[model samples]
Target chain A: MEMTVLIGLDAASYILTLLLVCIGLVIIFGMMNVVNLAHGEFFLLGAYTVVLLQQYALPFAVILLIAFVVVALVGLVIEELVIRRIYHRFLDTILATWGISLALKQLVIVLFGPGSQQAVAPFAEPVAMFGITYSSYRLFVMGMAILITAATFFILFRTRVGLTARGVIANRQMAACLGVNTRRVDRLTFAFGSGLAGLAGAIMAPLMSVDPQMGVGFLVPAFLSVLVGGTASPLGALWGAGIIGGSNSVVAAIWTPVVAQIAVFSIAIVVIRLWPGGVTGKRKR
Target chain B: MSGYSRQLTVLFWAALIASPLFLDGWNLGLLSQLMIYGIFALSLAFIWGQGGLLCFGQSLFFGLGAYAMALTTKDMIPGIPATTLTGLGLAVILPAVVAGLLGLALFKGRGLYGAYFGIVTLSAAVIAERLAINWSYIGGFNGLLDIPPLRVGWGSWQTELYDPLPFFFVVLVAALGIYLLLLRLERSAFGTVLRGIRDNETRATFLGFETAEYKAAAFAVSGAIAGLAGALFAVQFAFVSPAILGFALATEVLIWVAIGGKTVLLAAFIGAVAVKSVENVLSDTLGQYWLLVLGLLFVVAVVLMPRGLLAPFLQLPLPRALRLSGSKEE
Candidate 1:
């Protein structure tokens, strides 16, 4: 019973963090209709920021914020420079972002070498929960993920910036006509998405091996979440994350990580085949 | 095709044919490998340039072809024969079927357009790569090794293409065959219709054409061609790894085609050869930084020069028959 509860808690944490990691992708690929292949690299940049800054002995929360800011700034620069020109060209955006992905990967390898870094997680103390001892750090990560998820939901549905962003997503030309500064929205949306990716990277750094290729490992799973969830709604995304992340975490605990990967993929393929539109997908007829 | 483009195409082939005369055995072998990649690039050039379906995970098909060849020739499968012929056939067929079905599924109903299709393909490649890495039967992360080369003979008695010169000709023949085939298709009415669908699927649908079928068929043909390239790649490489069947190779090929001219088959082929050749030289000097250079070039190719760097030299003004009536195109 105790073991099952612990496993359940772990699974919940995994699902929540997986959602956190992929929400950025959801915003970029789902909401913006721009396929940012470099989304993973933003996450990578975030993790590497933690790796770089943890040496300064700053607070973990401060480091996470810095990671978000740094990556978001980088994203803003890219959006302004390369992405602004290719907004109308879907295929070109893919190639351009892929180029960015390659550059960022190489840049990391050039800066950090190919080896995995040793990133230390904060909050080493164990917390007792219902007669069970759990790592407080893991719990903290879960809390942070939940807090961020709630905050993102609040901002997206509640804030004026979010309203403006959604208005742009709905119709860029219309938003521009209505004085929404669609260009600014595009730039900020991309940066905000990238910032979310960075925060995800910061949180996941300690749990995952901090290598140059780590972002790629996270990318496909996030893609699956968005693909299966449908870009139509956030709740749909959450459900998709739950299915994939939950299965992955559970299977990883029970069997092997490799099996978990394969299993989740199979489930996704099956789900996709059965309902091609994803969870929020509707019939054309 | 215009006279200039025809002459350029002919000259390109002639130079390749005459290359062995000046080049050494090692360079010949390297050129052969690049030719296989040229074939791979042609596959993308056809489907993306002509068909207008930008497959982000083309490496899935390439990798499948390689693994098909590797498994068949190495006698790894329980029931299948281990002949080079069988390997080659399966290599061509497997990826085609997978891609055809996948295309059909994705193109069915409302249909997945643009980035949706690419992401799906990308995910497929990732899954395939992971499966290859995890499956111990296929040798896991170390990958399958010591695969047999292309053989020409009756069943029992066969001569392996061990010599680089002979293999070079074989690969050249295959590449040229694929190139010519793609060019012929590109000029065909089918190619026009494919391009029509690409330019506007809804309009094509309004014209009573099943755009999904067209896309799926184009995707299948592209996969078959890519598979053929992968099969040849396996024989030349004599090893197949999970790396070949994933996002890395997919993106690499995408870069080659984008830089070469995705719209022009010849340009894409040359782009692959040129990039690979340059990498061979730069790996010693720039090392990992070469990827950064490639990334920058890719971005430039996509943003400022969508026609690709080599398109000016390789592409010809299309004749009237290939163009839609009353449609103006440069």
Candidate 2:
């Protein structure tokens, strides 16, 4: 019974982390029709925020909030400067964003001198769950993931801006005809997506060493989830993340992490082969 | 080819032939490496610029070829002779077979196109890299080392390429041979059909061509050429690592091909040499920050000049019969 509970928690945490890391990419790709290959770099920037603020005596919550804002502002700048110019040109946008990713990685190396930084997890105590001891911080992260997902769902379905953003994503010309201010919507949506990725990085900073190459490790799995989840649907993100992350956690429990990674990748390929439209079979306009 | 393009090709070849006369051994060795990379870039240019298949994980084939050469030369594979000839042959064949299989899987039914194709290829590369890291029999994360140099003739009469000059000439011959073969193919009827599929796949299918077979063939041919380059690289560098199979090198190849102007073969070749040469010079001066400048340049190039910065000056106009834009039924 304890083993089952442990596996369940592990799977839950995996799903949440994957969802948090990938939601921003899903939004950026689905809504704006941009690849944003530098999504990982934004996550790195968020992690960097925590590393840089280690000297300051502040609560982890304040640090995370600052990281989110910083990443959002950076995303805004990138969107305005680079992404805005190549909106519909998909291939060019990919190459351009890739260039941004490379630049950001090297920039970090230049500033931090190629060494990894560390941070302490905010909640260090052990919590009893189903008669098993677990890291309280991980449990807190899982709760935060649920809260964030609920908040995103509410904002996306119940807000005026969300409606406009959805309208723009569905049909840009039609949305513009309805006076939705499509440009502003695009900008804000991109920023919001980047901010979410940043928050994920901040949340994860304590768990792993923060380095320039750290983003690439997260990027592959996140990308796999986005592809599997169907880029066009928000709900698809959850479904995809659940399938991939849950499977990975279960496999990791049974075998080595490396083998689990390979298994996930193989499964992703098989999924793409069998179901080209991803799990949701939804297409973007 | 047009008269101007013919002249440009001739001039370029002449410059390469004469370069060794003035360049030091160190620079000549670097130039030889560039030529090998040029071959790699040319394969990508053929598939991407002409065949319309944006392969994001081309380094997978290159790395595979390198490993094949290293293993075969080291006599690690049982029952196979460790001759240079066998190693090179295996290099080309292995990647070709792998590519053919992958291409069939990818393009057979409900084929992956454009960005989906690129993403899938990228995933394949990542998986290959990870697998290489874990598979300890082939040296694992550290990779194979001290791969033997290429040799000619047999037994007592064998001649080894210990000096950079001999290797440079060999690479030159290989590059020129591949260039000429690809140029001929560019003008062939098969090339016209490939371009047709690239421009509009459905339309090509309507014209009664087996589009998938042609795509797979192009992919296999491209993989074979890239494999040859990899074999040469391994012999020259005497090292092979998982890094060669991964995303970073793949992206670098894409940038080189893009910057060189993928539409033109020679341009892509030169682009590889130029970008690598620039990297060698700039990385030394700027340290890690050079990547920042390179990134900015890449971004600017992609956004402002999608056709490539060097393409206009280098791309030769095809003969009227072979022109890709005016696709009339032959």
Candidate 3:
């Protein structure tokens, strides 16, 4: 029974990490019209930030906050300098983002060398819950992800900026006609999305090895989640992530890790085919 | 066709056929690889330029072709020819079948814009590469080796196409055959309907043309040609790997087609050679930064030549001495 609990906890930690990343992707691709293929790179950037701060023996709280702000600023720069000009051209955006991803990956390689870097947990404690042991770090990551999601939902649904963002999403031309400042909304939304990804990366840094190609591993799952959840709903993104994350975890527990990844994508393909509008409600044109 | 235009086509074919003689072995090999890529680009142009399907996972079909060829030779499957020609046939057929099935699911979305189309295909490529890497029988990461070369006859005096010269001729002939077929298809009434569907799918659907069917057919044909190119490529390289179906390779091929200008099939060939030749030079000099240069080139091409490199050539003004617009003169 104890062994089973240990296995389950391990699997849950992995799933929760994936869920957080997917939730961030839902906000980026589902809300904004930007198809950010380089989103995983942002996650990498956040992890690198945490690593860098740790090198200087910075506090974990400070490092996490800095990671969020740094990644958000990077997102803003990308939006203003690159994504702004290529909003309407989807194919061009895909190619450009892929280019950015390549550049970021290479830059990481040049800075950190080609090997995976180890990250140390700032806090050393195993939290005991119901006679089961859990890493405090993993629980913190899971809790923070949930908190961020809640905060994002509140800001998106209950705030003025959130309303303007919805207005822009509904119809960019109409939103501009209504004097909603669609450009600012787009910039802010993109930054918010990148910040969320940064947070995920910073938290995940301790659990996984930080490497140049780490982004590629996360990219497929995040994309599958966004695509399956329907690129139009945050709630749907969470649900999609849950389904994918849970299934992948269960499969990995029963079978090999490789099979789990394959199973998730296979399921995603079937789901997308059956429901072209996605698992969530279709977006209104 | 105009007499001069026909002559130019003949000259182009002649030059391609004789290129191996003038170029060194390594250059000839590179040229052969470029021609295979050219064929793949031309296949993409048919779907993208004519049918308006922005397929990003063309590497899927290319890989299918290569794997089919590789498997047939490596395993010595019965009923499938061990020869390169039979490998080529299987390669083309499998991808066509897969594309036809995939198109049914993809074409259902009402507004399958370029971005979504690209993402979906890219996802497929990712899945394919994963499967390729995991499945060791298909050579996994090390790839399949010792693929036999093409043979022509049963007995003595039979030709074994091992050297660059014979392989070059084979690719040239196959490419020319496909090009002629594409030319004919482009002029057909079916081609016009495809263009009509591209311009306005709703209108074409209203006209009872079954736009989805046309798109699927075009995609299948394109996949088949890409498969042919892949089979030829496998033979040239004498190995097959997951890299054949990588996103980078797919994107590079698409970039070549886009840069060449999708308006004309010939431009696909020109673009493939030009970009690849440039890549060869850049990769030799810049090492890892070659992709950065290629990426910048992609952006610049998108901004300046929206119609692609072929646009300037098509838009060139006629000389005052030969200004007969309506006449079909050479």
Candidate 4:
């Protein structure tokens, strides 16, 4: 019973992390149509930021906030310089972003060396609830990711900016004609998406090994999540992430972890063939 | 101008055929590798330039071809032929089958656009690599080595392909055959319909042309050629690995096609050889900085010579060169 409880808590934490990353991807790919293959790099940047800030003996909350702001600024710069030009040509954007990803990876290698850096977790204790022992850091990650995802949904569904962004996604020309300032919206949306990715990276740093190539392992799954969750819908992102995360956890518990990843991709491909609009149905107008 | 162009073609073929005789053994080997990659790049051009389908997973077909050849050469099953001919046959057939099935599944969803197509194909390549790595039967990460050289006969006096000369000739013949086949296909009615589809898919659909079928056919043809190249690669390296299906290989082929100028098949071949030769020379000198150079080259190519290196050669203002073509009209 104790082992089962531990497994369930671990699974829940993993699902929450997947949910946060997928939410960021949905905003970037679904709303912006800017297939940022370098989304993982943004996550890496956030983690590094936290590591750098923590070295100065900053509080965990301050480190997280600084990491978020700095990474979001980097996202804005990338949008203005690189992504803006290739918005109309989707394939070109993918290739260019891949180039950026490679460059970012090399940059990280240059800065951090070719070794994995250990991220120090702020909370040292394990929290026990109902006979289940879970790391405090993991519980913190779950709470933060859930809160952020909820806040994002609220802003996207209720705010004027979100409505304008939605209009632009639905019909760019129509949105422009209505004086929506689609260009500004594009930049903010990209930055916001990247910021979320960065936040995920910072949050996940304590759990996983941080290295130059860490982003590569996560990139495909994030893309799989985006593809399986209709490309133009937020609810789809959540559903896709939940399915992938849950299945992966269960399969990994039963079988090998590598097999579980392969199963995730296979299931994604099968799901795509069966429901091209994704599991969340069509995008809402 | 047309006569001059014909003369140039003649000169090019003559140089290509005589190159091995003049070049050293290492150069000959490199040339053979380039020729194989040339075939791979041309396969991409057939789909991307002509068919308007930007398939980022061409490496899947290439790796499939290599694995097929590797498997056949190993004669995994006792009764299967261990000859190079059998290797080549399976290489062509397997990729075609895989591409046909994949194309059917992917081409159905309102085209899926270019980015999605790229992502899906990339995902497939990653999955394939992972599967190969996990399954030791396929040789895994270390790859299959010590593949025997091709033999032409059963007993004494059989020709061995261990030497670079024989291998070069084999690649040349295969490349020539594929080029001719592609040329013929380009001139056929089917080719016309494909070009029509590329230019305007909806209009072609309205005209009763089966756009999806034509795209699938083109994709299959591309896969077949890529597989043939992969087979040649296996023989040349005497090895097979999952790296052949990697994103790096796929992107390199794209760069070759882009640099060569996708307007003509011959241009793609020239581009592939030229780019590989330059990289080989640069890497010998620059070492780790080679990728940095390549990244810069990609950027320059996109910004400056969008049509690729061939554009300047074909369109240069050489005094009366531009006027030469119109002279006959005058």
Each model's lDDT comes to: 0.88, 0.88, 0.79, 0.80
Identify the superior model by TM-score, candidate 2 or candidate 3.
Answer: 2
RMSD of 1: 2.1
Question: What is residue B260's positional error in candidate 2, in angstroms?
Answer: 1.3
TM-score of each: 0.95, 0.96, 0.90, 0.90
Superposing all C-alpha atoms, what RMSD in Å does each candidate have to the true structure? 2.1, 2.2, 4.2, 4.3
Q: Which ten residues in a row have the lowest lDDT in candidate 1 chain A?
A: A276-285
> Candidate 4: where is the Cα deviation over 4 Å?
A283-285, B1-13, B108-113, B154-156, B259-263, B299-306, B309-330
Winner by DockQ: 2
Scored by TM-score, the top model is: 2
For candidate 3, give the DockQ. 0.38
Please give the ranking of all candidate structures by DockQ, highest first, separated by commas. Answer: 2, 1, 3, 4
Per-residue alpha-carbon lDDT of model 3 for B77-130, expressed as tens digits?
767757656777799999999998788667755645456677778778878888
Model 4, global lDDT? 0.80
Would you give the TM-score of chain B in model 3?
Answer: 0.88
Comparison by DockQ, 3 against 4, better one:
3
Error of 3 at B122 (Å): 2.1
DockQ of all candidates, in order?
Answer: 0.65, 0.67, 0.38, 0.37
TM-score of chain B of each: 0.96, 0.96, 0.88, 0.90
Interface RMSD of 4: 2.7
TM-score of chain A of 1: 0.94
**C-alpha lDDT (0 to 100) for residue B50 of candidate 1:** 87
lDDT of 3 at B104: 67
- Cα lDDT of model 3 by residue, A143-179, tens digit: 8877877888898899988888888998999999988
